[model samples]
Target: MRPGPSHLDTARAEIIVAEAGHRAAVDYVSRFGKWDARASVRQRPGRRLSGHRDELATPFPPELAPVAAHALVAGRGPDAVREVLTHSLYQYLHFTTELEELAVIPVVAKISRNRSGLDLPEAMRADAFKIYTDEAWHAQFSYDLVRQVERASGIAVRLPELPSFVERLDAVRASLDPAVRGLEALMFSIVSETLISSILADIPHDSRLPKAVRELVRDHAEDEGRHHAYFRQVLHAFWPALSARERRAVGPLLPQVVLAFLEPDYRAIGTALSAAGLAPDEVAQVMAESLPRRRVVDEVAGSAGSAVRYFTEVGALDDPATAEAFEASGLLLGAAR
Candidate 1:
């Protein structure tokens, strides 16, 4: 994690290879990008939903909805499942759109404009603009689908104005030195893009889910594959440029950023459960039973495996302090080093 002339020298070697990789990153936004031909926003109305399931049919998987599982176990019927599914869709949409607009887009814009202080090639900067457009389109389609679902399902959305990640991120920033806030934000975006999202990975392939849900998520998942690669490369390019002082200041905070982004918003979940007719005590029990502390830790660690590996490859975790931070955070307990 030491940043210095020697580090910069190593970064130079990596940058040469990274430059070739960026050249391979096509301008997806212009060529085959969803914005041109395959974007959800461009699909004809008739092509939107599968005929197999009506729009009001289940919008999300029951297994993915912890509250829905609790309701069923308690003998609540189809109505409860519907409520949970509707709320789940709303939560997913709100989180996706808000996270993109608030957290990811700003960092990407920085890279595109060469404000990130990384020595990436022109192709990489050009790709950043493509990513920005991709993300904006993602947010737009997410918002659009949520409103469409509301109309079709006759359910109103109940969600926090900002995703819970934003609140946790604010706390993390407030605890950091003012000078490193920008660096922390950059690392946060890198971790977020590189981490595998269960929703994006699993939703599109679940045939039991509605067609629109699968298609919408599939489009997003495809786009994210590119985003993931770009950010991983970004990390490769950015880490070696950090000064030892900057690394020490910012490195250990990586695991905290992972947690901030991945941790479930239990408060919002509880509120949704209550709105779906669960009593206060029932919502408490449901949340406790469904998202036990150990389970949460394991999930975060598992999901962050790839992102952690990126740090390890770039020597961030080689810093004893950074390793200790990750270990203490429980995000590296069983992860392969």
Candidate 2:
């Protein structure tokens, strides 16, 4: 049956209305904290930790070497401002999606307990809760940061009006055959969590950003360590269940996913450099030099360090495949070293 244009528009309007309501609820909960104000209160001030500046001593590899150079050569001013805006827009959308998804974790955790024998350890459970809490904080932080940047620079950074991540998530959720659940866990852990940690960690400590932005990144990095651990544990638990066919299917997908996620940062950087008034050649140089170093910082600050520690603790590094994959992916490749 052919629907009238008005009818289709009405349906889309309804969807938009429903999504807006969901987003409002998410924003309210994440920004203002839980309905019970007492529960949402911060007990202690979040500590600001400095990133390892010495880590830059390591030389960037061929793969990431260019980005670092590009950033260094990029001019400052409108181009740099635009770069920041572009990057912030991407982050705003990414974190907002995470904030919305993590908001539902409590419900998912409850369901896992009731329907599946997915018994999470007490520590792991706490970590999961902390992740949700941290994600909410990150959402608020990103939004506020964007707004601040817009006000300060007069660059209008656009936020996503719709939840585009839901399509990807819904696809994963629909394929919830228990046999594939571990793959799903790994998908979120490695692809989403690990990638994000690396990028956040890469953000220069001395970047001309506000103090609040730096602090938020630092706090989020600490929490991501725990989140990475939880996902690793889930992956370890599900390891034996994966058949050869499944492993083969999953192996190739990881790089693709990782590359897709990282691509946005590159685009943002380019836009920012251009907007900041850097010549194309200069932008290219800074990206070549700085981006790789940033990748190294991200790996160390987030999951790669924890994953290596986990491997050592559990004696899993003995597995040739695991060790090889880690090295090939540049997980253990420290900056230039």
Candidate 3:
């Protein structure tokens, strides 16, 4: 997912067409997709590590604090760093695989097969099929990389069987009225795709990470940039198709949807820290100090700024209840307009 200028151009073109009226833009995967030339699975790139040292040079970016911050305070050297990095990798792999398999594919399969209630264009539906391929490749490559990294680092992976986000998303879905319950996957899929993650944006550029790791992230980010554009168009089509009642029911769930993706998994982080040899009390202190309420709010708000604005553009925020929910969630606090 090493996004370059071309990816940006593709995204911009998609946005222009979507705004003009949800027409198909120049197809990224079809016209300019890197699947054949660059997808990790197709390309089958291998991990290139020095044979002398069995430990990873730096599995995760040290500059990425909270996790890295905890690593430093633990003072356990490479072992601590390795644990944090591997855990981070596991979390990422879990997100990539689970989201595709559970949350995204089900909704996308409906869209691709023209079974989703929305009246999407044939071109949009075709694009949905391509997204299915891309997401599958993403999950495949992510899994392959996890095994490669584990073998390389010799660190046992520690990950929750299900990521916290999935659990949280299920809880949100269960809490919804049955009338609008059907919209949970659709809405959350849109939010997940549209929300800009800093991890994807920043990781490829970080020089300290392993080449394979960086390449994998770069590939993922590049694809997600297109996905970000594509889903915005999906929303453009989807919002107009919803009835007022459905809109009212679903709009207030926007903040929770954003949070379901962006909020820090403190439990996962704590587990990672503890695995890194931080005493339980030390882990607690690090968790409390590194990721305070304000910082988490700020990061989530920042990442979610574009998605919120897109919802606003589509009139999801026009409803008083939806607007009030966003304000109460504080997702809009200091977020870019």
Best by lDDT: 1
For candidate 1, write residues 46-85 as lDDT tens digits: 2255344465566887767766777433467777678777
lDDT string for model 3 (74-101, tens) is 4777667667867877777777888888
By summed lDDT, which 10 consecutive residues of candidate 2 come out lowest? Answer: 22-31
Which runs of model 2 end up more than 4 angstroms from their true locations? 1-41, 44-130, 158-182, 190-209, 251-264, 277-305, 308-328, 332-337
Q: What's the CA error at residue 151 for candidate 2, in Å?
A: 2.0
Error of 1 at 240 (Å): 1.2
List of clashing residue pairs for candidate 1:
3-243, 3-244
Candidate lDDT scores, in order, read 0.74, 0.43, 0.74
Candidate 3 RMSD to the correct structure: 6.9
Model 2 TM-score is: 0.52
Collision count for each candidate, in order: 2, 33, 5
For candidate 3, the per-residue lDDT at 170 reads 87
The TM-score between candidate 3 and the true structure equals 0.85
Comparing 1 with 2 on TM-score, the higher-scoring candidate is 1
